[model samples]
Target: MRIAIFGKQFDPAFDEYCLALFRHLSLTGAGICIYKPFYEFVSGIPSIKLNPDSVFKDHADLPECDMLFSIGGDGTFLDAVTIVRDRPIPIVGINSGRLGFLADVSKDELPSALNDIFEGHYKVRQLDLLKLDTHIPAFGELDFALNEFAVAKRDSSSMITIHANLNGDYLNSYWADGLIIATATGSTAYSLSVGGPIMHPASKNLIINPIAPHNLTVRPLVVPNDFDLTLRVESRGGSYLVSLDSRSCILEESIELKIRKADFSVSVIERNGKTFYSTLRSKLMWGADRRN
Candidate 1:
């Protein structure tokens, strides 16, 4: 089996765990490749050997692999998605940061989790991604997001008006700081923080949640995933920010934006009876109330 590890910068404290993961994988006799920058950083540490031939600097240089290990927080997992870019490789996240809602695997569970993969005791689950259709083409070929595609006012002191439609039918004009079109996989992310409901990952639905709406009655709406939505934003600053997961870019006012489910879904590896429900209960403290 072939596996590649991808991540950004690392915290010094987590270096041992990272080294341990690589060492354990090496013992399995699987071919391994490390992201070039991470390879450089880890090479300086004592007793670490990273083959120069087994380094991938960018997505273009990354070889085909059975699995890709994302070794950071949820944001790094999202970055890994951009690297995969419609590829069928199953991704598993090894969380080394806080609030790992997406990157659920903890450092303590890394060894056992990897063993599950090598022993063929893991499940691959398909996750839907949201694709953005815009004339601007801000994100190049990596325009899809596993979490959400958002539009927000560029000015911190001002709000924006987003006119939205569902299949050419008027939805609503959102007067708020921003608007989020989040997938089921994203319900727990920025959407949740802005008063959106937590949705089951398998649910065939998309959520439209306003960020700090001027009107309190403007509530979040759930729509069928099949619907193609269009949005036009009016901002006082003459521009707005468009973000696909962690990648953001500026857009001019009145640039119409289109969003729909992507043609391909991302495959994520799940192991050790870690269901979405279990993650919710543990991550969100769903049933931890003292009165209960």
Candidate 2:
């Protein structure tokens, strides 16, 4: 079987496991291809020097394989999706950081993880993505966001006015730093940091979370998957910053963004031993309070 590797960075502290994992795969006789970004970051590690005709930035050059292994933290895993956007290959995260929600495997668990995987001990799950469309069609340059697409004020000085409408009906204009429209997969990410409720990956709900709203009554809104959100931003601080994971774009107030579920979804490699709620409890320290 063949497995491609993708990562943003490889930590020096985890070099041994990195090396071990590669060696283990070689011993297990799996063919490997490395992402160009990861190849530059961890060059000369005695790992197979796979040639990368394409880097993550170029997007078109990413090689295909049966499955892609993402090495590093959760951020790297998210970065992996941009490379594997709309592809059918299952992406698995091998964690090399603290409190990894997306990256599941710890360094110590590498060997057994591979054992289970090689022994057909894995589950391929489908994750729904929120795609932001400019609807301009010609500007294919900026379109989809696998995790989320957000528009926020650039500075802390002023509360930006974001007029939001649901399915063509006026909902409310949010006067806040910005708003986050997160997928169920992203509910625990930036959205959670700003008071959005954590949602299971399978939930058919989209979260419209306000970032530092000025009005106390403006709480995070959980809407239907069918809810079409229209966002119009008027920020005095600067042009609103729209982020698709790490990629950012600036938009004038005149531009309107329409968000809804995309036509496609991403496939993830998940195993049964690790449950989403358990990861939340372990990573976020949920219900960890102890009575002394």
Candidate 3:
């Protein structure tokens, strides 16, 4: 099997685990294609020696592979999505720090997870993505986000007013710090911090959540994923921050933004016996009450 590895800089404490991972992969006899920068970072460790079949700097040079291993935090997994955009490569997220929704595989689970992967005992789940349209070359080809599309006030202490429309019909004008349009996969991300409802990953829903809205009655709303959303921002600074996942850029208030579910989806590898509910229970400590 062929594997593509992508990662970011990690703390010195994880050196041993990283070394073990590389050593195991080397023994598997799988063709390894790694990110150039991450390869350099790993090469700096004296205890580790890597001789990858190839190195990719970005999406263009990324070779076709059966799977992609994201070795870092959740942010690194998100960046990995950009590298494998529209590709059918299933991503395996290995957490180098705290347990993350994307990077759920912990250090203790690494050995078994790797065994399951090599033995073909894992499941591939498709994750929906949101696409942004501004009628300009703002974000270019990388305009889709697996988590959410957010618009926030930029260069101003004052709050921004976001006028929203659903399928060309006026919905509501939100007077708040920002607005978030999140997919089911993103409900636990920025939207969750703003009191958005957590939707099951399999649910075909989108969340329209406001950030610190002026009105107490304006609550986060869940809508069908098939609906189209239009947003126009009115900010005191005449510009606002538009973000798709972790990537953000400044946009003028005049630019009309449109959002919809992307045609394609990202594939994530889920090892057997590891379900999303179990992850939620373990990661969020759901139903963890002494009385229970």
Candidate 4:
């Protein structure tokens, strides 16, 4: 099997696990194609020696592979999505630190996870994503986000007014710090922090969440993913910050913004015996209370 390795800088304590992962892959006779910068970082470790079949700097140079291994935290997993964009490669996220929704495989479970993967004991799940369109070509080809598309006031302390519409019909004017158009996969991200409800990953829904609204009556709203959303912002600074997952850009003017579900989806590998409910219980400490 051919594997593509994409990663970011990790703590020195994870060197041993990194080495072990590489050795396991080598033993499995998997052709390795690593990200160039990650290769440089790993090679710098005195205890490690890597001889990858190829190296890729970006999506343009990434070679064809059966799967891509994202080694880092959840942030790194998001970065991997940008590289794999619309591709069929299933991503396996290996967490180097605390477990995350995306990077669910912990270091202690690494060996078994790798074994399951090589033995073909896993399932591939498709994740939905949201696409953004603006009058100005701000995000370019990478205009989609697996999590959310957010608009926030920039360069001023004053709150921004976001006029929202659904399928060309006026919805509401939000007087708040910003607005978030989050997919079901993003309900746990920024939207959650601002009082949005957690949603099932498979739910075909989009979350319309406002950030710190001046009125207490404003609450997060869930809508069908099929609806098209339009937003216009009136900010004191005349500019706003727009972010798609981990990438962000400053929009100098309040151009009309449109959002819809992306045409394609991302494929993520889920090892056998690992369920989303189990992850929720473990991560959120659902049963940790002494009374429970």
Candidate 3: tens digits of C-alpha lDDT, residues 145-254: 99999999885479999999999999999999999999999998899988999888998999999999999999999999989999999988889999999999999989
> What's the lDDT for residue 138 in model 2?
20
| lDDT, candidates in the order shown | 0.89, 0.80, 0.93, 0.92
- Stronger candidate by TM-score (1 vs 3): 3
| Model 1, span 1-292: residue lDDT tens | 8998888777887888887887887788889888888777778877666663388887798898999999889999999988887889999998987668778998887888877888988889999999999887788988899999999888779899999999999989999999999999999999999989999998999999999999999999999998999999998888999999999999998688999999999999988588999999888888998898
Which parts of model 3 are misplaced by more than 4 Å? 289-292
What's model 1's overall lDDT?
A: 0.89
Candidate number of the best lDDT: 3
Please give each candidate's TM-score: 0.95, 0.91, 0.97, 0.97
lDDT of 4 by residue, 7-81 (tens): 999999899999999999999999999999999999999999999999999999999999999999989999999
Cα lDDT over the full model 4: 0.92
Give the C-alpha miss distance for residue 262 in model 1, angstroms.
1.0
For model 2, the local distance difference test gives 0.80
What clash pairs does model 3 have?
Answer: none
What is the TM-score (0 to 1) of candidate 1?
Answer: 0.95
Give candidate 2's error at residue 165 in angstroms. 0.9
- What local lDDT score does residue 41 receive in model 2, on the 0 to 100 scale? 73
Better of 2 and 3 by TM-score: 3
